[model samples]
Each structure stands twice: as C-alpha cells, then as structure tokens.
Target chain A: MKDRLEIVASGFGGQGVVRLGQTLGEAAVKQGLRVTMLKSHGTEMRGGYVRSQVVLSQKAIDSPMCETPDVFLALSSSAYNRFKDTVPAEGIIVYDPAFVEEIDASLPCRQIAVPAKDIAVRNFKRPIFSNAVALGSLAKLLETMLEKNVVLESFLEVIPKYKDENRNAFEMGYETMNI
Target chain B: MKRFLETGNFAITEGAILGGCRFFCGYPITPATELAEAMSLRLPQVNGVYLQAEDECAAMHLCIGASLGGMKSMTATSGPGFILYADPYGWALGCEAPMVVMNSGRVGPVSGITGAPGQGEFYLTRYPTQGGNFETITLAPNSAQECLKIIVEAFYLSERLRMPITVLGDQLLTDGMEDISVPENDDEMKEMGLRVWPRLYHKGPDFYPASDALDIPPVQMGYDTGALCSDWTPTVEGYDIEEVEEHHKHAYRLIYKVRNNPQLYEDFYEKKYMDDDPDLVVVSYGTPSRVVNTAVERARSEGLKVGALRLINLWPFPDRHFSRKTKYLVVELNWDGQLVREVQRAAPKDAEVKFLGCCGDLPTIPDLMETFTKMLKNQPLERKGWVLEAW
Candidate 1:
C-alpha cells in the first residue's frame, strides 16, 4: 500500500461479500498494514445486493469508504455490471467466470476471470466456500501489497471452522490466478 | 502483544470490560446489536452479568438497577431504541447513577433505513429527557480502536460526574472493521485509569443520604429499593422533597456538577492542521470526520490551506478548539442544521461559519473539497448554509 489502495468485493448478499473484504482487512492488519473495511448491505437480510470496501495503506487511512477500488472482485454478474464503469483505468477487475457472464473490456481496466463457484462446488461440494476461493483470488491480485501466506492465515483466523476445505479452495483459486 | 482486528461494536464491548463494566442490559437493534451480543459472550468470562431486556426502556431500567446495586453497568441501542430510553434515562441522571450507553445511530425518524449511518441523535443525546437542568457527557469515536478507548472514557466520566454518559457512534463506525491497538497488559489498563471505582456491592444502611455530585459512596438498591432515587426532586439527604429550597438546591446541583468542574467533565476534542494557519477549518464529529480528514489532505495536496477538527466529545460543545481568525465549515449527516446551529452559536462573532450538511447519505471528500475551495476564493457558493435535499 504505497499511498492508499481499496479492494471492493461486490455480489448479491449471502455470497459473503462483506466477509471476503473483512478477511482481507484482517490479514492486512496482521501484516501491520493500516486497514479499514466498510460493510454495505441492503435492508433485507439475504439475497439483496451487498458490497464491502476495504482500504489498506502503509499509513493511516483517512476515509473508510472507497470511491474507486484498485481491485474489484465481482462474485456475481450484477456485481460486475455495477462497478465496471466506475473502476479507475489502471485498476484490475477479477470476476468469477462461472457467475459473471458478461464483461465490457473496453472500460479501461485489466479483467481476469476465475471459476470460483465452479471450483468450490466441484471440489468441496459446497457453494458457500466460493467466498474463500474469491478471497484467495483477490489476494493474488493484491499480492504486491499482501503476501499469500498472510491471506491464508487471515482466512483461518476469520473463518472460525472448516479449515481444510477452505484452505483447499483458497489454494485452487490462488493457483488459478497468474499474478 | 498484538492488537486484534475488531469491529467498532466489539471494541466497545471489550473496552467496557476493561473499564470494569460488570453488568450489561440491552435490547437488540441493528448496528448496535453486536455490542449486546459481544457482552452476552464476554461478560460472563469476566464474572459479569448480561441481561437481554424486552425493550430499550426495560433495558435502561435494568441498567439503572444494576448500577444502583453497585456494579458499573451499560446498555446499547440505536435511533428508535435510544428514543425509548429517554423515560428511564432521566431518572438515571436525577439519581446520578453512573451508566454508559453506546448508541450506533442509523438513518432515522422512526425505524428508518437500518444500514445507513446518521447523526440525528447528536442533539438528542444532550437533552435525552425532558424538564431538567441536567448535563450529558457524550463521546464520539471515529474508529474501532477509538470506539474501545472512548467507551472507557465514557464509563470513567459517567462515574466521575455521577451521570449517564453516552458513547455516540453511527452504523458506519459500528459495523466498520479495523485493526485496533489496545493495552497489552491489564495492569496498564488500570494504571491508565480504565478501572471502575464504584463496586458498591454492600454499603450498610444510611448510605442513601450521600451526595452523588460530591462523589460520596453510594448505597445498594437491594438494601433500599427506594434509595431516594426518584425522578422527582430529592432532598440532599436522599428523600423526595417538593419544597422550593430543596428543589432549587437539587436541580442546580445536578447542573452545576458538570458546569463548575471543567477540570472533570469538560469537552474533549481533537484538532489537526491548526498550527499550519489554514484559511478554512472543517468541524465534524463521529464518522463524518473521516471524510474531513481525506478532504483536508486532498486540499493540502491541491495547495489549499485547509485543516480539520474532529469532536471526540460531542456534548459541552468544545468551542474553545476553534481558531476565530479562520473561516469554519461545519459538516454532519443530519438535515435542517441541528449541529451547525451550535457551530454558529459558539464560534466567535467575527468568524465566518459555513454549514454543509447532508442526511440519509454521507458527505463525500470531493464535494467537501469543492465547497471549501469555493469558500476560500470568496466565490459565490452554488449552495451554502444547510444544503437540504431538493424538496
């Protein structure tokens, strides 16, 4: 985190969008990076659109909310459509190809596709573990600022239980990313 | 020892435990509900009690009773629940029971949007109850770590002042997660004055006549349920008295305890960039101050002489933190200019006070930077003074 960088995970609620960002934030903090994660949820509990903006910096973070995210993780198609136009030109977009079908590549950002949900369902027999896969992919995109072990440790710290499958899903996602 | 990553609500609960809060009575509400949840889990580990009351009203009554029974107590709520608390809240003030309330305010009039952050309760915290010459101590924490630190202060001040103290945050701050640095040693926490003093578990009879303002040892309610703690005027000796002299002495004491002791209950504020002699100073409290920090830095990068002042303590309005020579901009997340009225009132007569307030949504740094830029150049504002939503 040179100046300040924000990573946003956007998806329909219950995809663990907030948890993905929260795990990253906690991992960043474990590395002594200043981090703030802002949770956004619709009034209705589950199935509604949800997003979380996690800002990390070497110094103190002034604003908790992120205007333009450096790394945008789209777990759903609606999530990809919502922020494609808003991401900065040099920013990167990481989307789950299994969920996000369409992408406007001309929007001036690097787009990387990962089969997060597919891998989670096939390997673990649980779609809920997609958040871990998504988080691991997000960490790959943020590798310059956060190490792979740091992200894995954060997942273990935050997940509370089911360490083995989450770890396998995370490793699969991490291996899928080229970064 | 390493500091843990915590949400604002969890940090408050952890800090309350460090502050020696032995009793927690609260009802569930969004944003603030986690504080109650955390308390239910953690209080028992510290040998404390956690009671989930039926409603905000009953929650506060239980809080009052717990504190009277001689344990540092607390409760948590949000916009609508905070309003429900006013009934018993007044008696807590009259009886001078030391209690801390953590209110994570949300967008509201009545059970409004639960996720959006709002500062509508800023003024409500000051005058929580009706018909009394009472003063409230309120602290607004901007981050998870500050949420922890500030709650400890809230509990400390409530005990020191013998009044209900409030820690005012918002949905953003409460739900927001961050790595918070805390004291490594419990001994350090005690040495730093985070310990509770009022463990009045079993004071003998005749403890009722003690003066709360004087910081005299208090009696347990189990000994005397009618410990002269009625909402009505009480005699200095701790009994109901409707007589003129007794009422005069009683009410004034309630007000003067905070007024005369600036050394004790004075406003706590944090000032930044004032030494740089900035042309414009932004005043804000709670989560809005985070945006002001960004705007201030952005303004400096753009070569504008701008600074920021964040109010950690909301009540007793720390006007003394202002530099009268500089133009001031007051920002908040409430419509109709409730806090700006205080900015206008407390700021020096010669100082120019500008208001840029928004409700239902947060004020962005770009908007603040643009407004401050216009104000700095003496340019006619596109909008100024209580910029309400276009009705």
Candidate 2:
C-alpha cells in the first residue's frame, strides 16, 4: 500500500458522491488506516455540485485537501472537466459515461468509462444502485490496497436497505472493472 | 476506547458530556447547527438537557441560567449568531458565570457564506462583549479529535476561571469527518490526557472576591449560599455596586484571574522545527494550521529553514512564542489580517512580520510552498488585484 492515498468523488448533489467517499473511508477505517473525509456542497442541495475528498494514510494525515488525487471518481461532466487535469500520469479517473459523455482525451491520466447508471438500470431497474456499482469498480481498483470483501461489507453497512441488490451491484461493478 | 469516523460536532458533543456539561442551549446556524443537533440527540441519553432558544442572545442567557442553577452548561453558534451573543456574553463575564460557548466560524461579516470556513472572529472572540473590563478564554482546535480534547479543556477552564469560555472553530473543522477515539471510562480519559473539573457551588457570603485566584467555585443561585448575580457591577457579597473601587475590584478579578494564571493555558500551543531557531516561523491557528504544518514539513524537506507555531489557546495571545526575533508569516482564513496584527504587536521591533490571508477555504499547499520559497529568497511578495494581499 502507498504511504498516502487521496481519492476525490464529485458529482451532482443526489448522485451519492459524498456517500461513495464515506463508504471508502469507512472501509479504510475498518482496515485500521488513518482517514479524513471532507464533504462540501454548493448552496442548493439537489442540483448543485457536491464534492467529497477522502485521504487515507498509514501515518498521520497533514493536509486533507486533495490537490492531486490518486483516484478521481467523476459522476458528472462538469466534475470530470474541472478535475481532469489534477490527476497525475500514474493516477486513474473512473467516470460514469451516462453523465460524462464528452471526455478529455488529451489528459495523461488513465480514464476508464464505467457505465454504472446503465448497468444499474438494466439489472436493478433503479438508478440509485449506481453508486454501489461505482463503489464496486473502485473496490477492484483499490483491491491491492483494500480488501474487496471489506469494501463490499462497508458498502452494505452504509446502505443497508437493499443488501442483496447492493451486493450484486457491487460484484457487477467489480467485474466490469476487472482489474 | 471507542473509535469511530465522525464529524467534529459529534466529538464535541461527547467531550461536553464527559466534561460534565449537562445543559446545552443554542440557536441553530449552519456549521454549528449540527453540534446543537448532536447535543439534542445525546444529552437526553445522558440525563442532560438540550434547548433550542429563540435567538443566540437568549441561548447564551439560557446557558448562564443553567450554570447559575448548578449545572455545567454550553451554547454554540456561527459568526452571525455569535454577534447576537454580545449582550449575554457581557452578563456571563461580569457575573462570572461558568459556561462554554462555541463559535464555529463561517465566512462572514454577516452570513457571508454559511457553509464555508473563515477566521473573521479572531478579534471578536477576545472582545465578545460590549465592555472591555473582563477577559475571555478562547481555544481553537484544528481537527475533529483536537476539538474533543479542547472542549473538555474549555469546560475545565471555565469552571476554574468562573467565566464563559469560548471554543472557537471553523466550518471545516466542525463539519469535516475524521477517525476519532473517545474514552469509554474515566481511566481511559485520564490515559488520553483529558482532565475534568467538577462544578462546585461557592459557599459564600463573599462570592465576588477581589483577589486574582483560581478554583474559586462559581455562585449557584438555587443553593442557600445567598448568591446574588446581576448585570450591574458586583460587590464583594454579590450586590449591585457603582463605586469606582468596587468596579475596579470586580474588573481586576475578571481580567487578572485569567491573565495571572497563564501557566494553566500557556503551554496550549504546538511548535515544530523551532529548536534550532529557523529563519522563518509560520504562525497560524484552526484548520489552516493543518495545511501550514504540511507545507512547513515539505519546505523543511526541500532544505528551507522554516518552523511552525500553532496556537491552540487563542486569547491572552501567546506573546512569549513571538519573542524570537525571526521572520514571521501569519496565515489566516480571512481577507483581513486579524492574527497577523497580533503577531506584529507581539514580535520584537526589529523582527519582520507578514500575512497571507484567504477565506471560505483552506490555502492550497502549492500556494503556500511558493510563498515560502519567495519569503526565503527575500523576493517581494505580490498580490493579484484583491484576491489575497501580503504585508
């Protein structure tokens, strides 16, 4: 595992952006990693943009701001466009193609298109489970650093209403990434 | 010890309960509203009282009433709500009411930005009330975990000082989430270096003492101690007095009780890389100091002789830390340089003091690193338009 890992998730208010970050942070905490999560939203709660910056470290975390995120989860086009440049060459950008149709092809970072919305709608018939799908892909990407089962357990713990659906959605997401 | 990933508001609520705060009266404001909500949810389980007042003034007054009735009390608000606390703040100070007031500062002259963090209240906390005769004790914690410890310390100080103590925080500190460990019992609390002072009723015919002392229990009205308290200048026996000498005695006790007992809170600061007297000292408080620590550490790695001084005890302004005749840079979360002014006043005449001010957010590390580089190279620090100016 890296000494410090910075993950940022940004999208519209209702896209479960903050929840995604919180789930990852909770998993990191269960793994005994020092974690700090900062969530910020615009004036409006629904339509406005929301962001959550999560920093996980083996040691004490000094700066919580994700100036350069190791992993960038973009659920909205604007978020994809705004933060595309902050990802270093070795960093990865996981974006939902449903919201981010136009991608920045010139960026040095590796960009993966995860059609979470389409997959969730096709399988579960509800777009709300897209977040679970997204977390699954993130879990696969962070498998080397975090345990897949732990991440899945934390996701289920965070959104406990539909445990079976979320588990399936998470597995689908992990399979989609296939890292 | 119980560990959980939670917001600073949750940590503060637990801290207040551990410190014997059984009553909380607050006016809901963004950033601080969550703290009140947490109190409302948890206070009842602990057999404590949580009240939502009509306004901030009424809220602080209610806390004063609770404290007078022999209960450790607390109140919280943001910048806008804290402005309304001027009336009761003076009353609490003059009557020597032991309570805790938390101002989770948001970007504002008046509700400038409800959700964003700012440090506009650096001076407002020192002079929270109208009259300047009394001194106020204020603690600023940078993170959620520190917020827990500081709130507990604030309660301890309030009881000993016999005045309303302010725990100053910012939006980010109160609203941000982090992994926090809370003590499960008194043994664990002591193992974690946490202290708690019980609320003691003054068995007094002379409740208002003229001397500057510590651990003098505050007057409890419900008891048969005949404790008298009011907005007026208090006499030795807690009566209304307008005489200059009696007012002098009251003022001295209010101011000197804290000023004279600097040893209690003087060590409430963090110093990094200052042992060998580095060329530059970065001074800051609250959330911004976290970034400053990182930036300073990075600068040191790059061979820059820089140090960091983080003030946890904000009021009584730790001047002793500024005695070193070195270049000082004060970073704050406000456009106007409030803390920078204090550093200038406290530093030696020959020492150079500068300011880097930002609001509504923490300063980026790259910006801080570039500034440190420029300051070390003796380059002129420039400001773009009105974004952020340097002194």
Candidate 3:
C-alpha cells in the first residue's frame, strides 16, 4: 500500500466476510505494511449482518474504519445495501453478483460484479470457499495497490484446511479479470 | 525479530506467557473468550497450566491460589465478569498477592451488548472491591503490539510492587487484529528486561510461608508451608490481627506500595506534534485514541495548532501529563465521562478543558477535526459528544 487503503468486507454470518479481511490483513503484514482489522457481527450467528474493516498503510494505521472506503467487497445484498452509498466517488466496490441483487447507481464509484459464490459452488461444490473467491476478485479489482498472487498466498497461509479447493476457488475468481 | 498478525487477545496470551504466566485461571466472556481459548492451547506447550473456572469469581480466587503456590497467575474477564471477580480481587490485595487481571471491557451497567466496545469499567478496574483503600496500576494499550508489551509490564508491576495490576483492553481493541512484533526468543526478551518473579519458597524446617513476605507468592502448598491466606489484616506470622495499631502498619504498607514509588510506578504517555506548545491537546486512550491521532494530524495539516496525548497508564491518573499554557480536550469511549473528570481535576487551572465521548462507536476523525477546529476559534461545542449529525 502507498499511503493508506481502507477496505470494508461485508456479508452475512458464516459467509467468511471477517476471514476475507483477516486474510488480506495478514498478507499486508507479510508485505511489510501496517494493518488493522476490526470485525463486527450482529446477535444472530448464521444470518447476521457481518462486516470487517481492514486498513492498510505504509505507515502505522492510526484508525481502521473510514466513512468513505477505498474498497468495499460485499458478499450479500444486505451487505451491499448496508454500505452501498457510503463509498466516495473515487472508491471501488467489488460485489459477488451471486448474492448481491441490487446496486445503487448513485454510489459514484467504480463497481464490479463477480459471481464468486457461483464459481465456488460450481467448481469446488463448497460455498464456504466463496470468501476466498470474493477476496481474489477484490485483489484483481484493486490490482494496482495489491498483488493478486500475494493475496492468494496469504489466503493459503490463513486457511490451513481445504487447501486445494480454496486455492482453486481463488483462481476461478481471479480468472474473471473483467473489472 | 518476527512480526505476526494477531488479535489483541492473542497478543495478551503470548505476552503473559513470555512474562512467565505459567498459570491462567479465567472464565470466558464475549470479546475475552478468545484470550482464554488461546491460553488453553498455548499455555500447555510451555509447560503451563490453563484452568477454566466455572465463573469469574472462582477464576480470581484460583489465580490467587496459584500465585500463593509460587506461580505467576492471570485471569481474563469482561465488564460483568470483572464484577464477579471483585471480592476475590480484594482478597488478593489484602494478602499482598501479585497477579494480573485482564478486563476486555464491553458496553455495560448490566449485561450490555458483548460485541459493542466501551470503557465502562474504567473506574471499576481500579476500585472494584470494597473495604480498605488500596492502589493498583492500570495500563491501557491502543494496539496489539502495545497489548503484548504492556501485559509483560503488567506482570512485572504486579510482582515488583506485590499487588494486583489491571490491563484494560476494550472490545474494539481486544477483538480486533493487527500486525505486531513480540519477543520471539529469550535474548530479545532479555534485552527488553522481561523479568518473571519466582514464587516465594520457605526452605527452613519451621518455615512460615505467609510471613512478612506476603508480597510475593508463598511456598508451594503441597510442600507444607504454614501459610494462612486470609483476607483480614494479618500479623507478620500470617495470623489475623484485630489490633488497630498493628492493622495501621499493615494497611499502610498495602496502600503505599505502588503509590509511594512514583518513579517505579510512573505513567506512560504518547505525545505527537506537541513540541511547540499547541493550543489544544486531545487526551484519550484505547481505540478512540487512534482516531484522535489521525484527527490531530488532519488538524495540523490544515494549520490548526492541535496535538494528542494518548494515556498508556490509566491509573495513577497520569496527572503529571497535563500542563498550563495548552488546553486539554478529553476523549474516551464511555458516556459516564470518567476521563474528563480526571482531566478536570489534574489539568492546569488556566487550561481550557473539553469533553468528547461515546460508548458503542469511537470518536471519528471528521467529528474530532471539527471539534478541535471549533474549540480553537472559541466556538461553543455543538454537542456533548463528537457525533456529527447530533452536533
């Protein structure tokens, strides 16, 4: 990261929204960047609105959250709806169209829709790996700041199990370089 | 030597282990549960014992018992659970036992939302227990790295002064993750003066474990040391004493242990861009301090004479930090205004004081930037706290 890149990953509980932020944060740390991540979830464990704020900077990250994010990655429509209008005109939004049904055109930011869950379920038969797919999509969309390979390697390090399947899911989403 | 991306709770667990916390007696609570989980797995690899108590009260007593047996002990809890551990905490103080208590404070009064962050237990960490007046050191670290560093200090301050110490980590910090560097090897730790106090051992045939040296951990209970661990004021021989004059000596030692040694139990603060005597200095701790730091820089870039003082040591009030010529703006994560009251009492009389606080969310950068800008122009504060819409 050059100065500071604020990233927000939002989805329902068990959708691995927090894990996506963590994987990105861990990769940033390994890349010699300062990183801070705060994960918030509702009372419901399964379907609650879950959000993780990841801030990366060349210098120490004083705070993690920003009202206008540099990147917003949404796995669910509720997640996208909750934070759609929050990003600035220069910011970017990477959403998995498999879950996010609607997008606000007035958001005034670059928007890309990736079928991350669809790719995960169709290729690996495991929707749980959708987070890794979404992360790969996000990395590709924000490729100028972060390296796609570095993000994938960090996911491998963070998720100890289901190695081959998770990597495949990330690759499948990474192949969708249309953003 | 190595950097690891870990949560504040994970940092605390490793920090305690590095500081020689061989015994962890804790009851899990939200935001603090992961600390216990990490300890349960990590402690055993280092030949330490991780005991899961039924409740916070029992956890506090268990730590006391372990400390008495010559083990550096710790117990982790949140707001409601910390209250349960209060009475046993008093016992630890009265007996002059050295232990560390981790309070991952949450929104509270009753069983508030466990996920939400708050500095609700700011005062509770210091004077939670009833009875005789005693002083304890409380440390508030803003980052995961600081969490790892201060917990080692927590164990040290507790043992060196022979009293309990509290490390307050709010939910925002505790549950969050950050990149931090910890002492990965013995040499690195040694260079940083990471010392662990060994338990007190009585080698004599008629040895009294709980003698005058109740300050340190007593003899191993299995070794047959005549140690009567009592909450009441005790004699040099470890027996309870009812006399007022004798109690005076005992009480005086306990109360003045950390208070008298100002140099040893001194405060730790962070001052960024305050060299030229700024007109307004934002005072805060824990997670909210991060935003204030950002706001200070934002305000500074705009030619506003603004600075920040992040209080590392919460207790002893760090009254020495505030001075004249520069006014103070107190920021915190609680509605009770605990930090402002301290600022009002300790800061210079001529210094103008302001308060900005919240419970669930932190004081954001934009709100603080505006507040600092208005305060510099002598504009009245729009709201009690720093939220923008309401202000």
CA-lDDT, candidates in order: 0.81, 0.90, 0.81
lDDT of 1 by residue, B142-196 (tens): 9887777778888777776777898899998998888877675677676554554
What is the per-residue lDDT of model 3 for residues B175-281, given as tens digits with 9 covering 90 to 100?
Answer: 99999887877788766656544545543332222223334433344465565667666666656767887677777776666667766556467889878888899
lDDT per residue, candidate 2, B1-391, as tens digits? 9888888999999999999999999988888878999999999999999999999999999999999998999999999999999999999999999999999988888878876889999999999989688888889999998988999999998888899999999988988889889998888889999985556778776788998989888888865777678888888877787789889999999999999999888889998999989999999999999999999999999999999999999999998899889899999998889999999999999998888889788998888888888888889787655755447
Off by over 4 Å in 3: B192-225, B384-391
Q: Which residue window of length 10 is worst by lDDT in model 3 chain B?
A: B203-212
Q: For model 3, what is the alpha-carbon lDDT of residue B318?
A: 77
Model 1 per-residue lDDT at A108? 87
lDDT of model 1, residue B312: 82
Who wins the lDDT comparison?
2
What is the per-candidate TM-score for chain B?
A: 0.91, 0.98, 0.91
DockQ of every candidate: 0.73, 0.71, 0.70
Model 2, which residues run further than 4 Å from truth?
B384-390
Which regions of candidate 1 fall more than 4 Å away from where they truly are? B190-214, B222-226, B322-325, B383-391
Instruction: Choose the strongest candidate by TM-score.
Output: 2
- Candidate 1 lDDT: 0.81
By the DockQ metric, which is better: model 1 or model 2? Answer: 1
